[model samples]
Target: VKIRVGNGRVKGVDLGYKVIECEKIVVAAGEGSKYLFQTLDIDIPIVIRRKELYVSEPYSLFIDPLIIDTREDSLGLYVTQTLRGELMGSIDYPEAIDDLTHETTLKHYTVYAKKLVRLIPIMKYSTVMRCWSGNYVTTPDNSHIMGRDPEWPEGLYISTGFSGHGFMLAPYTGFLMARHLIYGETPNTMEPYTPDRFRMGKYVRESLVIG
Candidate 1:
């Protein structure tokens, strides 16, 4: 996909061979968003990281409800027994050595095993069937970046830098993004999350991010 800017305004985007023209563009490209914006000479302050997860084979139902460990050292270690009787979870750890690969490590397994076993002793016996990793889009403040880019071509909006809470906060983010883009409704609550804040050295750091 390619962005199209012309005549001092965004003309929409070029999707492969097709050009889908529009008045505005909302770039919610997650971890790749920084690169995407760079093509247009806009700098997004985002850091790319990787997170790992593990899943257990089906077993008899025992534990319920999503368990979250809110300790600072293990801020996002969470585990839950799915309805299918499988236990699934992940833990927050230092960023991977390589930021571009979804490589899983024994370190993730070893650390998560210790945390899960402490929460649910039966997890010690549960068979871990599979593990995987994915990318995370982080920011200096760990909060989101929203609204239009003041220096970019007009009609460009960004709603990324979600850290790791994008899924949980999608509905709210979508709502604010839609209203801000379509209606020019810039609420006072959103002032703290603008990308310009980073340029001005103002950060709204959040400490509750999960893995």
Candidate 2:
């Protein structure tokens, strides 16, 4: 896949089989944004890290609110019970890798098991039904990248690098993005996330990112 730019503006996207024509384009590809941005021959401060999660067999409802462990020993551990009574959560992997592989390791599972048992002793008996891995598209400051820039293709915009808060912030981000695209006005809420901030050496530091 590639983005087509002509006369210093977004013309459309090349989807291998056909070109979808459009004047305005938003790149919200999450971890895949790096590849898409390469189509435009531009670079941004984005990194991809691997995260692993597991879901346990259903138990009687007990936990209500999401539990987060931010202690020095468990910096990225979080556990929450699903509506269906299944326990699900993950501990963030400390290392960052350049590749985009979704491979989960037994070491992660063992470590998580130990930590979860320590936090909720009853959880030691809960069987892990499944495990999975995913990518955390992150920025230098751990905040999302939003809005567009005048230097690039005129109609090209960006909205990625959520680190781990994409699902939580998607609705609000989309609303502000729509208003900006339609009325050509940058909402105050989005002012801090402009792609230009990286160029200006201004980073938005967010300390609340959890696993």
Candidate 3:
């Protein structure tokens, strides 16, 4: 659903321009962040990409937490072990998706399933069961937008453009952002992802380990 935004006030009293009635706002808007910043009128140049994942299993199971490989430009399959010793896998494809449906692709399963099975060395004889897609947002440098707005410390704040790595790092990002919101200060660790870096031509590319 779409949330209608207006001048932040009610009963003829302006509550500091933003009516959220809080000291700060951390915008972890996910894929919708592409349109979310329009509310504040900041051009944070990013794109929303649709992505797909796959699930499958053999009669037996193997493996651990999600696995990824940057070379495929798609999600490397992750194997999950079931109680009955069957295997389930999830894939993160890199191809741009056009819609939000979790549709499965045959070619994707055909290519990634076998590789996942091979990684564990026990599924060379198994077949894939399912696959799906979802939405993702990314930026040119793969860094996140953090820190207080220089001109609007009291006006607004946002945190988006996670690319695809936010899920794994959100726990700490949340703690760090929450501290910034409540205390108005963040450590030097988060200083690199200033919101205005893109506009000022000051951007740092993230390490390729998790790309």
Best by TM-score: 2
CA-lDDT, candidates in order: 0.83, 0.89, 0.60
Best by lDDT: 2
Which 10 successive residues of model 1 have the least lDDT summed? 92-101
Worst 10 residues of 2 by lDDT: 92-101
On TM-score, who's better, 1 or 3?
A: 1
Candidate 2 accuracy as lDDT: 0.89
Which runs of model 3 end up more than 4 angstroms from their true locations? 1-23, 58-94, 97-99, 114-124, 151-154, 209-211
Model 3: weakest 10-residue lDDT segment is 5-14
- TM-score of predicted model 1? 0.85
Judging by TM-score, tell me the better candidate of 2 and 3. Answer: 2
Q: Please rank every candidate by lDDT, starting with the best.
A: 2, 1, 3
lDDT tens digits, residue span 1-211, model 3:
2223335411121235543343344556776665655645556677666665544554643455545543453455555666755565555544654355556677766666656755666566666566556665667787777765565434356677777777777888888888887787778878778777776788888754232
> Per-residue alpha-carbon lDDT of model 2 for 75-160, expressed as tens digits?
57899999999999899765747657788889889989988998999887889999988988989999999998678889999999
State the lDDT at 195 in candidate 1: 85
